[model samples]
Target: MTPSARDVSGKPQGVRGFSGALWHVATRAPAELFSALEELPPLVVQVLHNRGHAGVECIREFFNEPVLPHDPFLMRDMDKAVSRISQAVRDGERVCIYGDYDVDGISATAMLIETAILLGIDVCSYIPDRVDEGYGLNTEAVEKIVKDGVTLIITADCGTTADEEVALAADAGIDVIVTDHHHADAVPSRATAVLNPNSPDSDYPFTGLSGVGVAYKFVQALAEEYPEKLPYPETFLDLVALGTIADVVPLRDENRGFVIDGLEVLRQGHRAGLRAIGAVAQRPIETVTSSDIGFGIAPRLNAAGRIAHAQLALDLLREESASQAEQQANELDALNTERRQLTEDAVSVARQEVGDDPVVVSVSEKFAPGVVGLAASRLSEEFGVPAFVGTLIDGVVRGSARSPEGFHLAQFLGRHAELFETWGGHARAAGFTLQPVNLPKLRAALVEESRALEGDVFLGPQLHADGRVFPGTISFETFQYLDQLAPWGEGHDQPRLVVENVCVQTARLVGANHLLLTFREVAADIRAIWFQSGQHQADMNPGVRVDVAFRLDLNVYRGETRLQMVVDDVRPSAGERSLKE
Candidate 1:
């Protein structure tokens, strides 16, 4: 899990530039063994082997549809959470589902609401305003729910760290069943029934369940108790995939099965709400992929949380009417665009202030609370360091921190817990708050922590090329074979193909910074383009021999399709095959 971009001035030998070659025969055996291995396709073997699948069985499982998940009752506290919620429903207690503002939170809320509805229970959702009310359950929101006669609260995606608020709700006679996936605290005495896979007391096999994953499990538990209330329990996997991918959970274990099977349901284009969202996002549901969920659908769903309230996304998910859902979806799309702009602007400003620090820490009183996480992630990307983006909210300084590969944000914050009012998050990303006066102490502590660590603060990027291949091996057939590995997400990435000592028959600039190249392989001639490669074009021109690292992709224009090599990196070759100028 190396950070992709960093200065590679004195990098160790053998590492390729994002697509560098590995496992060469010269470094292993003779040409006979190398040829034997090459016969198997290097790129395919490299990718498959990198992901711990060497045999045909593993490869088949990797590509094929995953198996069904075990029963929800397999979870530790599913029964307790479900029993409490069912009791509330039977007692006619007004229940409010409090959820987070992100896609995970929204989907979790929607899942709970739908499950409750199936049982003929009256359940409403409440998502805090990102700008005004901030994150998690708050006193104001609790008072309002209590006033509305809601005596039971089912929290989704949040409330793990809301110890005080959960106590307040209990004082007001509202019992809380927190069905969350966030990391558990040490004390762990907040909610009445805390059903989190990450909890220390839990024995769930896979702890990377998204917020929606926990919600689905809770609903499944209820479905078990009241079998007549719902049909088969696995029908809501489409929502599962949406939130799972949106939250960037590792697509492994139960999560892999959830998304792999869930994607089939999403692609069917049956759900009115999803259909409407697909329409607004302008993606054909029949052609939906994992990439579509992350790039097209999730952002719009998350937009409501960033700009206003996550309830909008929850409502859109639960909407029964096609027209109304479509309208809401369109609004979400607009809000997503606004969110993108805001995040980009914040990232630009934050990057300028990061300087050359190994650990980036910056604060902005004006940054939107919803977009800070994204901004911190982008800053981490640009600077190759863990980043913290903070904003002053209602006398409390709250922010999101995104960490690079080697850095553990949660552990780092935990070491400095005395400075924070509340702090909890995953290894890669986290959220926290402290007094505005404590900001300087936290920043100083982070710097000291990074300085005390040995060696590079950044993890060196390791480019695992799928396999080595001659330039002639790259063709339409090859591209199609590689594209078979679709629906790529976390735990699986697109394969990289490498070509060695190819003569740049011709090269020129196309659109602005794009570089188009006509290259000559041993027996094949092909045209390739590198997007945003003005500097590379100036460095290498016609007749220069070079090694090109790129990924295979299909390009379509006016319905005509052709295979293209998306250049990742190019370096001058020292071989004797240079074409004379």
Candidate 2:
């Protein structure tokens, strides 16, 4: 049978994975098209087409060709930002860079600070204490910066929506240059310059830049003024890639260019601190992939802010001494360990708070503000609903929300802005602040609004594969064809293939909750690992005909590299074993 056969319903089937999830396989490429596109792997074309990259030129660039970034000055107020920063440097004024605490914020802070130092300006950085100051510019942090005798304040990863804080700084005789990439309806008017591509007023070519991406653009604009003193933007792509991937921004358009070039810079191991962190994370920095940054390295950087002061992370990024970098890396690794435990404990408690409602709202003082977002993420994933988790701090509730694609958390929060002291984020994820008394109001409103828009409107725990494939085609040869399309993330997810009528040769439980199995589905020798699927072992035993969905990975064992299938889902075949068997 051809792999490209269209199913009766193209939408997610919903509630059918062996793990009690959903799987939505894309339509198959036609048989005639396989012969028409024999030059390229048929599966590759199918996946690209499913993602809407149809034309030849677009596919060629996404497949392998290099993508040059747009001019940095193309962003609105970029020229103004560069001019003001240049004047601050020439006048020998003391400047402070106010930034957030997440990986994107820290990386952007590092890049912008490094740029200011190269221009011979006296620069210091201020990363708000996560627990004390919350996400963005707080009145207390700005007051402290004003007291530090700073004449100019630069922001990275935040400040685009901070009208009050910017005005506070301006009232104290400080010119605030806001450099953020968060979603904003309008830019802060009091700031000397606002540089955010996502701003409604912006006419930049691309709007999906991470906080660090915007910071990189600002650095690029400044570099044009003194190209000799500052290394070209290539010097900081490592930071750009880290922030962009960790922030989970779309890996398309110009972002694709940053990661493609940045991955090469990361392999050079030029930055002492990042190299040290990579060593602690057990990732080979020399061959780091975009996925490595997202899963392994970025968490360690974020842990510094989650469990302790994110300033430690910012310091680690800029540390020049190998010994100091190693010490900080170890500290962050320990914090990440602690953070994992905290998130687990919090999720266990928050699980009880979820009811039969279409949405989830759980609040407690026991939840750490730093890790509430993680718990909210877990709850959202586990229950397939929008999750809101928050902790009570000083009579105020600071929380985070995560939703599926069908639900727009930002718009939902904006419609109920009266309940929040502050709220800003993308459609799927956001952070918010509100009075403790408004908790029930927000909770009731979420459920009311969500139920109104239910029924396949938002993204849920569904697995979307490239297309179906025949058992014979699942081999090392197919893996090699797909691996050429590297640097995948957010918009460009790793391609998944679904195979039907396959039999399991053997299956055994491994590592507490994982399934290690051998499949007789392909002639090539390949092992399958179904992570967290040990519970389904009985149904997937030897001789059981089943269908499986998986992505390909190159697994190295004892110095021998081999193709492996990282299973996403498994279910019984359409019918029982044939009588011929």
For model 2, give the 10-residue run with minimal summed lDDT: 1-10
155-263 per-residue lDDT for model 1 (tens digits)? 8888877788888998888888887888855423656788788877778877888999988888777777888887766788888888899999887777877887788
Candidate 2 CA-lDDT value: 0.85
Residues 233-270 of candidate 2: C-alpha lDDT, one tens digit per residue = 67899899999999999999889889988899989999
Tell me the spans in candidate 1 whose CA falls farther than 4 Å from its real position: 1-42, 54-66, 187-190, 394-396, 454-467, 483-486, 502-549, 555-562, 566-581
Best by TM-score: 2
> lDDT of each model, Cα atoms only?
0.74, 0.85
Query: TM-scores for all candidates?
Result: 0.85, 0.94
Which residue pairs show collisions in model 1?
A: 16-20, 42-466, 42-467, 43-466, 43-467
